[model samples]
Target: MIQAAAAILKKEITQELRTKYALNTILAFTGATLLLILFTLRAHQMDPTPKSGLVWIIILFASMTGMTRSFVQEAEKKTWAFLQLHANATEVYLGKLIYNFLFLLLLHVFTFFFYLIMMDMAIQSHLYFMSAIIFGAASLASVTTLTSAMIAQADRKGALFSVLCIPLVVPLLLILTRVTRFALIEGAASGALNDLAALVGYCGVTITAGILLFDYIWND
Candidate 1:
């Protein structure tokens, strides 16, 4: 299972690099978002604290845009059957989750640089923030990948994916945003142990569910 999943992930990563897909789009959108925020806050006195949740909001939307494309190419080709034949359900789910997590993590790193420049926010502990971003984004990415898989089978996959996923992801988004806002506003005062715990728990549960349920969805 592990090997199979790794292979799928490698294939996904190769395709993403070959086509310059998710990362490019995510970076472009992220850049646009930073620009918009900068212009919007130009005349206003921006809060040095976590007063504005703009970063989290931008991340959530940008993540959604990036994640949606993760499965789009496979779905377009109706290649679910071929994937299943190559690997078991667990491998498929894990591979998707792995690639999705890596994809989002890259976006997080790129956006963090932009946030520092645009907001002039001090990320006091670089290592700590990077670690938090990685875990938090991985959690969100896993959930998004599972939801994207579910949507890949639907008729209006993109729209339906958003409708279903947005509501489900609100809690994660809220907690992550609050944590990010607090860190940006209060520095190291923000201890994200709770959020991290919840994210890990959620990832475990969702990955398990995705693995178990994928067969039914794919066969349907």
Candidate 2:
């Protein structure tokens, strides 16, 4: 099972890196998002308090643009059937989960730098911000993996993925946004630790759910 899963992940990651498509799309999307935010808010007197939830909401949707592509590409190529045939549905899901997580992780890191630069948001503490972003990214990954699987076969993949994913991700997004807000207003050490804990718990639960449900999705 481990070997089968590993092989699948390796294949997915190879395709992901070998093609300029996913990375380029994500980068362009992130850039456009950042530009829009900056443009819209530059003339207004914005709250000095960082609205962490708002930030994460943007991140989540931005990340989705790429998540939609992950499995949709396979569906387009008609290669998903080949994957399903070689591996158990569960294994295929695991492989996709791993690949999706890695992709989101990299996006979070890159976006963080751009966010700081463009948003001009002063970090109260880099450590807390880092921890919050990492946890938030993980949550995004887990939720996205399942949603992508759910919509993999849909004709309108993005629309379906968002409808299914956003509501489920609300609690995590709320906590993440609040935490970032606090970090902006109160600084890292002073931010609400409880929210961070919630983010952690949300990630754990979401990932587990994805893992367990993945087989059903793949087989369906």
Candidate 3:
């Protein structure tokens, strides 16, 4: 399983490096969204609540746009059948999950920096903020990866991806936004630990469920 996952991961990383399709699209969309927000709110001072909301909003949509390519590309290129011949469903899912998680972490980091720079948002607790980001990204990756696999053969993958992903990811986004808000406020650490725990639980559950169900989805 480990070797299979590693091989798949390497293949994915190499393909991504070669084409840069998902990476490029995510960066472009994120940049344009941030720029639009910057220009729209240039004169007004924005509060952290809405700023936090906006950050997750951008992440949600940007991730929806890029992460769907995980299995979609495979299906499009007819490589999914090749993978099924050589690899177990669990290995394929884990490999894709890892790739998506890493991709989302990088995307979030880049977007956060630009969001802070352009929107002038400040974090009071860097520790809590980074923790929220890590778990949040993981949760997003887990859910989207499974959903991508589930919808890979659908007629309208793009629309179905968003439709399926939104409800599944909403709970995670809510907890993440709350934790991030706590990270931003000076004295908002009261519930930070609890919220962080919730985020951790959410990530764990999503990944575990994906592991259990992915075989059925992939083979179906």
Query: Native-vs-model 3 lDDT?
Result: 0.89
Task: List TM-score per model, in order.
Answer: 0.87, 0.88, 0.96
Q: Model 3: which ten-residue window has the lowest total lDDT?
A: 41-50
Candidate 1 clash pair list: 50-185
Clashing pairs in 2: 52-177, 53-177
For all candidates in order, the CA lDDT equals 0.73, 0.76, 0.89
Query: C-alpha displacement of 200 in model 1, angstroms?
Result: 3.7
Best candidate, lDDT = 3
Model 3 Cα lDDT, one tens digit per residue, 76-185: 99998999999999999999999999999999999988888777667888887888789888999999999999889999999999999999988988898888888876
- For residue 73, what is the lDDT in candidate 2? 77
Q: Which ranking of candidates, highest lDDT first?
A: 3, 2, 1
Clashes of each: 1, 2, 0
Error of model 1, residue 46, in angstroms: 2.3
- Residues 68-144 of candidate 2 have per-residue lDDT tens digits of 77678778899988987888877877777777777877887787777766656677866567777777777887788
